[model samples]
Target: MDRVEKQAALFNLPETIVPHSVLALGYPAEENKEPRESRYEENRVHFEKW
Candidate 1:
């Protein structure tokens, strides 16, 4: 998150600890179970061109 220092304090992290990133997981909401379109696109791939 943008506020790493504040977040660290919430978890009781020591001041000396240097945090780069944080991982958070949670249960999905039931309403969000609907199908979604594919994000993959062939044009986005690159072989050797500019």
Candidate 2:
């Protein structure tokens, strides 16, 4: 996060661009893990869409 200039240069990106966050994606190391559950309310989810 501190070295913005170096990061951009390393990836050959333009200096004008700025990165706000980093996302690391990968699958779980173990298989058959139970998924966590969450309650879904129509009003909480849809907001003004409905």
lDDT of 1 by residue, 1-50 (tens): 55887766756666776567656746576667666796869996433322
* TM-score on alpha carbons, each prediction: 0.36, 0.42
Write one digit per residue (lDDT tens) for candidate 2, span 1-50.
Answer: 66776655555655666745545757787885687685757565322222
lDDT of 1 at 45: 49
Q: What lDDT score belongs to each candidate, Candidate 1 first?
A: 0.63, 0.58
Score candidate 1 by TM-score against the native. Answer: 0.36
Q: Quote the positional error of residue 34 for candidate 1 in Å.
A: 26
Clashing residue pairs in candidate 2 are none
Candidate 1 has which clashing residue pairs, if any?
Answer: none
Error of 1 at 35 (Å): 25
The regions of model 1 sitting more than 4 angstroms off are 26-50
lDDT for 49 (candidate 2): 20
